[model samples]
Target: MSATEHATCLAIAAARAAADKKAEHLAAIDVSERLGLTDVFLLASGANDRHVHAIVDAVDEAMHRAGAKRRTREGFADAHWVLVDYGDVVVHVLQNEDREFYSLERLWKDCPAIELPADLAHGGSRDGDSLGGRETTAS
Candidate 1:
């Protein structure tokens, strides 16, 4: 089975929250078939600990607002890789280097990605904005 409607909604909310905080490399994997523990895995990365914390806070708040209870939260102290489990959706906020090293996307490559909103498909605003939240232009 794939992600439930509720789970998809939660993931979308979490992704949007992450994006609003200028998170990068946002992706959502449907892990229901691979891992029954959760339906979706939402991944995002930040430049540093402070950025990671901000993304995490936004994700947590959004998920809660979406009616998902906090199941478990880990790695907030270091902010190297914060994992928030909300039963149906799990949000992962990681530092850029750590994210590259761990490569959660590579590990979950077999799963299909959730089609994020157009704005978040590439981690943030698509109208000439970089994934790092900086405006860019054709150079």
Candidate 2:
């Protein structure tokens, strides 16, 4: 299935919010050309439970403001990993320990990374280096 630009933009906004919350290993995967369920997979890691929760909240709020509704959310209470399903995109907010243990990046290595815009990648600024971000627009 293919995702519209609006969906992708909203996903990017969500990813930015996660990064603003200081989530580690932040990355977005453009799976639209290859996957049936969603267009992008935004993954981020928090240092601990509280940070994980905060990241999730920030993303959710930003997405909601962007008119994206979450279809499902899991693992909030434990905060080891929180999966926020936003129909066209799926966001995985994980704790540092859980992220290392799960290593979703390795699992989805075949999928190319989603590259954010210069300003967004650097959190509204363009000074920092790329945070392992990548993307594949529709062919």
54-127 per-residue lDDT for model 2 (tens digits): 99999999999989998999999999989999988899987766766776776677776766654444221122
Candidate 2 wrong stretches, greater than 4 Å = 1-3, 118-139
lDDT of 1 by residue, 45-89 (tens): 898999999999998888878888998999999999999999989
Q: Provide the global lDDT of candidate 2 against the true structure.
A: 0.75
Q: What total of clashing residue pairs does each candidate reach?
A: 0, 6
Candidate 1 vs. true structure, TM-score? 0.87
Q: Give residue 20's error in model 1 in angstroms.
A: 0.4
Q: Which ten residues in a row have the lowest lDDT in candidate 1?
A: 130-139
Task: Please identify model 1 stretches exceeding 4 Å from their true place.
Answer: 121-139
